[model samples]
Target chain A: MKYNVTITIALKEGMLNPEARAIQHALANLGFPTESLSTARLFKITLDATDAAAARETAGQMCERLLANPVIHNYTIEVE
Target chain B: MKYNVTITIALKEGMLNPEARAIQHALANLGFPTESLSTARLFKITLDATDAAAARETAGQMCERLLANPVIHNYTIEVE
Candidate 1:
């Protein structure tokens, strides 16, 4: 079966995110009273798997091995 | 008031996505029978706005002007 998967990766809470800060500053400069900003990365993958369970397991392993940095990132995988 | 916004940016349908292709190939090579993959960029922003309506408008404009490329990318904004 073919599975559609989505992985959302984000920095762990309390981690300093300079990119978000820069975006907030940019918004402020653009006349938007921005106080703060946070950013996340989303990846969508379609693959052939035996079942939804297998797809989820594979995707979670992918996140652990490559897609997310365990030290600073947290990721969630959804399979359909 | 403070508004939390999420902007999801993605390549328009039918566009060639080399990054997705690369990820698919990587997954296939990793012993996952990946047939295809799609990717999207998600940005989370927290800002100060007058109200939800204003926040939505500002975020939509931001996506239009800076966050997303109109020709090749489509974006959606959600304000909370």
Candidate 2:
């Protein structure tokens, strides 16, 4: 079967995120004051897998291996 | 109330996505062949707003004015 997967990767807490800070700064300047802001990368992949579990497992591997940096990133996976 | 909002920005159809292609190539070289792959940017913003509706409105405005290009990229907003 073909699986559509979405993986959202974000920096772990306490990590410095200059991009998010810059965005927050811009928002504040635009009158949309934000208490805090963070950024993440979301990857949508289409691939062939045997089943939902298989897709989930492969997706997890992808995150560990490439999509995310394990030391400073955490990721969530959704298979549909 | 303090609202947590997430905005996901993706390339519109027919838009050239070289980054996605490069990642897809890497994934293929890693033995996880994908039918296709795409990427998006997700912004998680925590800000003060009157209500959920107010928060949604502000987030939508943010995308229209800054977060999304509105020409080649489309964005979805989630407020929680």
Evaluate all candidate structures by whole-model CA lDDT and list the values in order: 0.84, 0.93
**What C-alpha lDDT does candidate 2 achieve relative to the native structure?**
0.93
lDDT, candidate 2, A1-80, per-residue tens: 99999999999999999998888889899989999889999999999999999999999999998889999999999999
Model 2: DockQ against the native? Answer: 0.88
Can you give the lDDT of residue A25 in candidate 2? 88
Q: How many residue pairs clash per model? A: 0, 0
Tens digits of lDDT, candidate 1, B40-68: 88888887788999889988888876778
Give the TM-score of each candidate. Answer: 0.89, 0.96
Task: Give per-residue CA lDDT, model 1, range A1-80, as digits (tens).
Answer: 88889999999999999988887777677776565678888888887788999899999888887778999999988888
The alpha-carbon deviation from the true structure for residue A57 of candidate 1, after best TM-score superposition, in angstroms, is: 0.8
Candidate 2 — which residues are off by over 4 angstroms?
none
lDDT by residue (B1-80, candidate 2, tens digit) is: 99999999999998999999999998888989999899999998898999999999999999998899999998999999
Q: What is the lDDT of residue B51 in candidate 2?
A: 99
Worst lDDT window (10 residues) for model 1 chain B? B27-36
State interface RMSD in Å for all models. 1.6, 0.8
* Minimal lDDT window, size 10, model 2 chain A: A19-28
